[model samples]
Target chain A: MSEWWSVVETARRIADGEVTAFRVVEDMLVRITRVDRDLGAYLEIDGDGARTAANEIDRKRKAGEKLGPLAGVPIALKDNLVTKGIVTTAGSKILAGWVPPYEGTAVEKLRAAGAVILGKTNLDEFGMGSSTERSAFKKTKNPWDSSRVPGGSSGGSAAAVAAGLCAASLGTDTGGSIRQPAAFSGVVGIKPTYGRVSRWGVVAFASSLDQVGPLARTVGDAALILQTICGHDPRDATSLDVPVPDFSAALAAGARGLRVGLPKEYFAGELEEHVRAALDRTIAALRDQGAEIVEVSLPHTHLALPAYYIVAPAEASSNLARYDGIRYGLRVEAPDLLTQYSKTRGAGFGPEVKRRIMLGTYALRSGYYDAYYKKAQQIRTLIKRDFDAAFESCDVLLTPTTPTTAFRFGAKATPLDMYLADVFTLSCNLAGLPGMSVPCGLTPEGLPVGAQLLGKPLDEVTLLRAGAAIEAAVGLGDRRPGGFA
Target chain B: MPTLTRKEVEEIALLARLHLESDELERMQSELGVILDHFGTIAAIDATGIPAMTHAVAMDHAGPFVSLGVLRPDEPQPSLPVDEALRGTPKRDGDLIVVPAIIPGAKE
Candidate 1:
């Protein structure tokens, strides 16, 4: 019943009959009752749904039937993921009353593996903004300091995991959504290589950049969740046919004989002093563990934010066009079809979503396509080329996850300023590389700092290996976000 | 930097089918201009000979990740049932999803 138990640890106890699935589910509900009111991590609490699932798992265990890998583990899901009979809001009021017809591929896999669905967590509306403030619903607070923001659009998932509200959670990283929040909240989160996991039933943000991954208190738990979700799905056209590796095996590999690269450009820029110090310490720890630390430069890193804004919005503009009043979700009553479309969208979407839609419309306008959208795609190629070249010199690359630790809720006044918070993590999505954020150390202010690891395509194993080594060296166990310790 | 004027912003909003309030219109103009100006950095990059990459990772049949050739036979597949599809519709009648009528002579 301890929140400190990693997903693997919880699963083992369940397998050995040390804890019944029902009891674990009950304990998780009790914890949520006591803690989640202050955090606002979960937008909806599905105690009944989770309990029913848990009871079924317990019944199977009692009947001498084998359980799945994640037996009885309660996991939080980002609101964007479609869950059968559960409200999937995507943190927007537009879809306030909509319950998806079915579940997402990742959610289905988790259910099959015996993970209980606790509830849907909050996010920036349609995953547009870095801070969860852009959510049409309530903003999720950082567990470390409620005044500070949990880096987001996956803010709720990160906060939930950080607060020990769930054993682990699933978050979709479209533009550093998962990693930056995980960094701020002091959890391990990964955005697997593009197409490593299916994007079948998840609400599309930026189809090309969106990736569903896990947020966990420990590296092993992150790997466990990632393992369960990775593989091919015909439903997603871009899903890879690659084999899902046994990620747990990589944890035992450690960091020895691995060459970890430090991208020079990542160190440069307006990175906060505490973040840099933490990065330096993380590098030293990895070097001490016999991993060769090399200096590499991704020269095109500076262009990531610009290219990403253009590319993601363009995709979002198209993907979100489906919300015309005729189908599911909120609709405004208007005399004409056009007016209904306008009113519904304008009233439903938040300011950030509107801004992006306008920007994307401009970018893809009749005459402006070549100047913006096409150019951004070309820039994406250059960004990928930079990562491709850097990987040749090192097995993995490391950098600070965010330029600064979590700031106050209203710290970023302008939309452009908020966009800058994602500068460090955006390049990975642009390049379609697998990357992760593992807590390397804490800032002097007691806020957590995450050091990111970037790996070659389909090479998450090396990143996890390095992450486990660094997690052990830094000992993420000491600092408690809200109440776990 | 290619800045947007109010007229241009209105036109863009029209294209996006979002009816911004008057104040929201003004705010959108300023905010979008700033974002587009910021995005000028990408266009400045000399991408003369580089082909545009629509997907950051190649999903082509020859690509390492999708090397197995992901072309599934295009046979009919089971999809969401009609009742399930219509379940969340805001307005519906007899399984036909409802919407505001097309304005007469209001050609899009």
Candidate 2:
């Protein structure tokens, strides 16, 4: 059996001095060495760094220092987060072996709170794909079924948490990268509102859409991870200046009297039979907890995917332009400058990354800008307006995190088909709303089903409150992936 | 139903600084064409006078582009050490990063 504890439980045991921090890190490292080859969730393990951090935590405890909230909790970081001296590849060959000189604000905050980072997890190259197959390094397998892919670009982070590789993990979500994988791996993933978590030191995909959040075994663990890393950072101009509410406190408040809207647009079509059945059960359970299920309509829902494909790539092209190989990362040389740029980029980026860059470049070209880029931005406004109107009737909107569950590897061969996998979760990113995925049920075949909760912009407290209630009622925590355990 | 032509795909590859093999180029011709066709719905929408959304979250009204909330203040502060900043550079010569000549010996 595994000695892996949830985030909160691990912290409590460490804070109480019942378990040494080094011991905890060593145990997790042991488990990782044994199982990570099968799961492929981690790209690299920082065993020495983690041991040193854990030893410091233990020393602090021995010195009678007050323990921080996440004292001794083992955490995994998505490879995109800059950790000084740790390679931050963002799952792209272009950045292979590039170690960041600075730390991202989120990683910095986690260390301050006494979290020991065990390793960097794999991701879709630059977080560009809905599935982890886009990762150039390693494809992360869904913990529930090795034959199936872990939904990604945050796939490895989600898989690591679900497989008990770490107490918690942080993953950045641009369009459902965090939540979709969390859903696929049967864990809880939260993508805070666009500005809630600072993006400084995190490699950018689409600057406006990317936000770092947590994946964990439970809603409470997600809350604990969020609490440690949230708050304004001067470095990130877009970071919210607003104070973070006690997310853990929100977990205590049950779903009583909360208005949970079931958006008709989300449930109307394309849902698999098993997933719909699970979502229906989740809705009934929420209703039993006194959450009033209001049926709301987000009329412009279907337009979101197309708009996101435009907006995200357009931004990605600009954000990814920094990889000229003159400054950081892998560089390819040629006789001339332009040739060098082409050669390095051609060799560095994967097909998915290249596809986005090309599409984005095409969309933003002068003549087509008004038709493709501007028009997409306008649709973005409409999508946000749809959410604005829905929030007037309900406190939080509920939907299936994905249309189906964990899909087999190579299932979505075409780019468009893969993009459609994020259909339900994309709108929340476009609207800049706080959204989370919590495991609710499983299909008859044993694949995990994720029920998503989306709240108004900056209204995560409401979303988490409902999600916690759903989590409590379902007792989804006990439903572990069999193979890893 | 806008579709990208082969020439257009090649042109876009040049602009993106990507050198696509013939196979990849042919694939993109069909893939990008379909992607653009899907996005045609955006163009189909009536968005006259509908303001484009530039930011997902409203700005602090004091960052950049003060008209619509830009970025953090322009104030200067301490930053990374010079060595740390240069550490990731693939080709650095004692604090100076070396790059291929762009302007063709205008100021080597």
The per-prediction i-RMS, to one decimal, reads: 1.4, 2.1
For residue B89, give model 2's deviation from the true position in Å.
1.6
Number of the top candidate by TM-score?
1
lDDT of 1 by residue, A1-485 (tens): 46667898888888888888888888888988898888889999899999999999989999989899998999999999999999999998899978888989999999999999999999999888887988888978899998988889999999999988899999999999999999999999999999889998899989989999999999999999999999888888788876788888999887788999999998878888998889889899888989999999999888888989999999999888988777888899887898999999988988898888888888898888888899999988888889889988999999999999999989999999999899999999988999999998887688999999999999999999999998999847756874444
For candidate 1, lDDT tens digit of each residue in B9-108?
8998899999999999999888887888888767667789998888855667554345545577979989889988889888888878776557585533
Error of 2 at A226 (Å): 0.6
What clash pairs does model 1 have? Answer: none
lDDT, candidate 2, residue B100?
Answer: 74
In model 2, pairs of residues that clash are B64-B70, B64-B71
Error (Å) of candidate 2 at residue A133 is 0.4
Per-residue lDDT tens digits of candidate 2, residues A235-294? Answer: 787877787899999998998899999899999888999999989999999899888999
Model 2 TM-score is 0.97
Local accuracy of candidate 2 as per-residue lDDT tens digits, B1-108? 778789989999999988788998998899888888876677778889887887887664643222233454778889888998988888878989887777876531
